[model samples]
Target: MPTTQQAIPFHLAFPVHSLAAARSFYGELLGCPEGRSSADWVDFDFYGHQIVAHLAPEEAGHRQTSAVDGDAVPVRHFGAVLPMAQWQSLADKLRQADTRFIIEPHIRFKGEVGEQATMFFLDPSGNAVEFKAFADIGAMFAK
Candidate 1:
């Protein structure tokens, strides 16, 4: 069994086309609590981590991909690993909201690296975000 790492919350700052869009997506839709902000940027509580969205439409959105398990996984993206139920709930919520998925929610590496469910979608600014879960949390990092 693998041991969990000491959780030191991470901070990330990314580009967004619009602050209002980012707020609606990360705050209202995704349910990430908002934090400090200015005219140029806004911070969101991304599952205990700090992610600041800065106004930079030119820099927003992912453009490259790398193949992974037969999927064109976004080369640049960020997300969190959730519990199975939580992941499913969020997936349902997104679907109900009529979100356009980059990759629909589904199990990956099933029976190989344990049952892992994952999904990918874009924020209003076109920034890709992924949410996933592993049936066996301890095996998340299995090699």
Candidate 2:
């Protein structure tokens, strides 16, 4: 008998300013299906991972940053690593929606180890989300 390996999905719980805004951003805009919810929080099926957004107005936005590859990368952020094509499609959709990107979609670490396409943007509550893709999936963890 042969054994198959399966990828494990992660669970992340973050604060949001409002549940309505979270529903619109994560559910309607990003296309993540909704799951169980309460008056204070909601769950989103984020690219097969479980992400829960809890209402906490004071803890919603990222205020710190670090310099990375000449960009002020948000110190606190979360997102998915998608295939190249899917990443591009999502980028296009975001552009079409007139999203204000904290880091515009572009190739990062060009001609170097772990080169990839990436973008970053904030949600309605100012939570940072980064989406990225690797030309060669095998190089995702290359040194």
Candidate maximizing lDDT: 2
Model 2, position 135, has a per-residue lDDT of: 96
List ranges where model 1 is wrong by over 4 Å. Answer: 1-3
lDDT agreement of model 2 with the native = 0.95
lDDT of 2 by residue, 32-113 (tens): 9999999999999999999999999999999999998888999999999999999999999999999999999999999998
Error of 2 at 133 (Å): 0.2
TM-score of each: 0.95, 0.95
Candidate 1 to truth, TM: 0.95
What lDDT does candidate 1 reach at residue 68?
77
Per-residue lDDT of 59-117 in model 1, one digit per residue for the tens?
A: 99999999878888898899999999999999999999999999999998878966689
- lDDT (C-alpha, whole model) for all candidates: 0.93, 0.95
* Candidate 2 wrongly placed segments (more than 4 Å): 1-5
Q: Whole-model lDDT for model 1 versus the true structure?
A: 0.93
